[model samples]
Target: MPVVTVASLKGIYPPIATPFADDGTLDDNKMISNIKRWSSATRLSGIVCQGSNGEYVLLSTDERVHQVKIVREHMPAQWQLIVGTEAGSTAATIDMTKRVAAVGADAALVLTPSCYKSRMSDEAIISHYTSIADASPIPVILYNMPANTGVDLSVAAICHLARHKNIIGLKDSSGNVVKMATVRKKTDKNEFSLLAGSAGFLLPALSIGAVGGVCALANIAPQLCCDIQEAFDTGDFHTAMAHQHRAVEINTAVTSQFGVPGLKYAMDMLGLHGGPCRAPLVRLTDDEKRKLDAILRDSQVQHTERIHDR
Candidate 1:
């Protein structure tokens, strides 16, 4: 009954951060608050939960399903909700995907299986995705974040899967501009799309022909991300470049230099409720905080003034 069409899944969608309580538990209160904030903040085509930035690797299967349900229950009706359904094993991933789809997630994002990285040749990886895609109740978005997953979904593998009627698009977090370009150029452009996985690569990906992005950086600066895409669409390259640079600097700090704590701090500073990250992941040190603050200030993304309010 749910629509699995490609048109509905294309655009800037942030795999949003899961805000936790000070005690490091899943803060439903803060999570719901972020959902409300994002729905009104930017031109987000949709919302993605439990992806790498959301700490999907750390959560239990039950926790992932619950988060998906809560996000779906609270998110705006017009926005498509995509859940990160990747698991350590194919059977487990497929099982989790079914539960999430039933809870109203419009799509399931499955990253390449990584535990057996050496053994996973292109053939094995294809078997994994094809089997899950064949059984998933909802549409599938292949997530290619090599930094975290180690296993890269090469352009050829992506092109091969694009022919499947239910595999919609790819979120390439590999940070390799050429890989994104390759997927964009070689895939069935009509049936599939390339979503820049990292905000740092959004402009480069777009210049080479990507449809949109699913950025961790969007967790902090949503409007700028939207504006970059808008600028390109409307023939405003200068503004797009300006926004693109700002996004790159901010993403570098929050995602690469500072990681989760820096992101949570920036989110809190920007009026979004980015509470503590879960256990095992500590907050930023004082020196790190000072540097992160400086980065945000330089990029003009840390001020109380909302880019949207302007």
Candidate 2:
């Protein structure tokens, strides 16, 4: 198969939240409906399945594969579907990535090796990713979410990996704007792409030359996310900054403060189905919901007064 490039994966692609059934299972129908809805709402280059916000670690391997199949079957053909193949071990990650590639996913977003944080050096990360990128059928995007991984791929390490023919881009979720800028300055402008992992920092990252984003904010507000990118693309700086601020507020509520359940609740409020999150990932408290409502309203996400109707 021909390799897909980082530039090919550019734009505001949502690492979409996986919707669930009331029984707390992967809701295939709801997911299908949501994917179709989001695809229609924005100019997303693709959708990323089983990403961190998707609670991928909570899913079984079979279920992950199944979800990818469902998204591909229902999503528009023009939209590329990227799969998160991050695992605790190289063997498992590679096995899962190959299986995902076999299922026709456009690319695999591989997280940095993180189980034994003390042992994960730059060489270790490079070797782990290089091995996978070399062996996998599809191209690889380095997923750098240090907040979760406890390990970060530095600018030098990323620039080295970016030079590889198969390691196309890195999703920097570190929230370190300076590191983002450094990476942008160090990497070859034409060959490698840098994507902001959080919508909260999309404009700042973009202002420094990020090509796109794999934003969590896009899960609940796809059109708004696209609008931010569109505004920047059209040189509408004022609109972009305003949208970015809104994105930061929403992200704080759903991610930094409210967690997965809050994101699901926000989704439910916004006309999308964000059913109960799976076990071990409990529902948001009523008090928390009340707080989320205030935040959403403040962000204008709850302007319609239908927080639960949808």
Candidate 3:
């Protein structure tokens, strides 16, 4: 795989949700449809398969690679496909990174090995990233999702990783603006792309110096997410703030508050195929669905009908 330029990492890229059949099998057709719809509907930087939103943790290694391959085959040529290939061990992470790269992912989003969270010292974290970046065939983007992985890559550790030629960027989901600012100040803007991991704080992240975002909200509202960045780029802070404000409730609803199932349900309501979440991850309850409907309405998201219609 070729190295992904920092330019390719800019703008809004949705960590797309994985569609599964009622029987718990990957629904290739639904996945393809969702990708096609997203590509045509908005100007996204690209699609991220097998990321946190895609339920990467729940997938087997082969399934992860296969999902990326399928997405790559169907996605627009201009769009860069980034695949999450994190594993418990450096060797395993490297191996999976190679496999995904072979299947056509433009870059790899490697999460910290958090099963041994207590032992992941700053030195251990730096060593882990350096080793993977050194060996990964594709450019590596560090993933910091402390909520899920229980491992937060500190600003110092991130800056250290940014110096590596192969470690190109970071997806900071910590929602810590001060930390993001510190990392931005330390790294070279030309070499290390800083991406907000969630839409909740994308506007603030960009205000500080983040180049773009890998937002879950982009899955249901790509245009809105992109509009926020577009507005900021054009010196339209007023418009950007409005969009950012609207995104907050929905972003929280679909992400930190509701999780993937909520996002899938939102997609379904909006006329996209957001089928069942894989087992062990249940569908939104009727009560939760009602609340999600209200959030979507308040956020002005397009759903099956008006909230009043319900």
Candidate 4:
């Protein structure tokens, strides 16, 4: 395992989807195999386990911890391991945070508690994160995923949490880059960091000071995601824009258009293990799978061209 440090977090990370056997059992062998492949691929700062893409809400606490354990054991010793540990209640969140830290997580990505959405005011939001950050053994990264959680972290609340020493950064999945830029302007850059939650806007986010991203698209195209960051960092905006535009359709397919099952299918197409999602989250239909196949084939053609250009 790598030594956990906030400074080492400035690059791309794939919020990997969990792999389940056909009968719906956890596939440990597949999980280990995927992490090893991802670590050796191209340029990833780390891996995020049990994120929304990982189906964390559907998993048992023990299973979630097991996911982190497998990742820690197989991932490169130089790669950081970030684990998602959000729960419905504050006490549950704090308890899970400690459990993952005991295993090997460099940081915990805590989503806003939205079970009581009406009551999750700015004050309540601040109090929730404050309690967790105060108790967590590792640093905390606030996760603002409005699409899934319904509770979005206000800039005021995020800026307030930035004052806490234990809270290190945020993964804003809202796709509102303007708000993200506003948060960047308001918060202390050294004490706090910002991460794009999706690859759709990753290039734009980095342009406005986001450190990197935790893209679901990276599961199938890790090197593609790295190319976008590398192009931007080296001041090649024209190439970066081209890469971002070409990625949008495929990124949309695996994200809002099809969700996790679509992303898993994409992974399987690339010779990785993405067997099936758990119950309640079904697999794609035969027709939908074909559509995804067509999308991939087309994307690959464009991606190959970019590789040559670079």
In order of appearance, the predictions have TM-scores of: 0.96, 0.94, 0.96, 0.96
Whole-model Cα lDDT of every candidate shown, in order: 0.83, 0.83, 0.89, 0.88
Q: Which stretches of candidate 3 lie over 4 Å from their true place?
A: 1-3, 303-310
Clashing pairs in 3: none
Q: Clashing residue pairs, candidate 1?
A: none
Q: What would the per-residue lDDT of candidate 1 be over residues 1-310, giving only the tens digit for each residue? A: 2364677666688878888776666889888988877777678888888887798887888888899989888888888888899888999999999999988888889988999899888899889999999999788989887887688887778889998887998888888898777777787777987788878989888898787899887887778888889998888999999889888888988787888878888888788887688878888888988888888888887552375645
RMSD (Å) of each candidate, 1 decimal: 1.6, 2.6, 2.9, 2.2
As a whole number from 0 to 100, the lDDT of residue 139 in candidate 2 is 84
The whole-model C-alpha lDDT of candidate 3 against the native structure comes to 0.89
CA lDDT of 149 in candidate 3?
81
Give model 3's TM-score versus the native structure. 0.96
Total backbone collisions for each predicted model: 0, 0, 0, 0
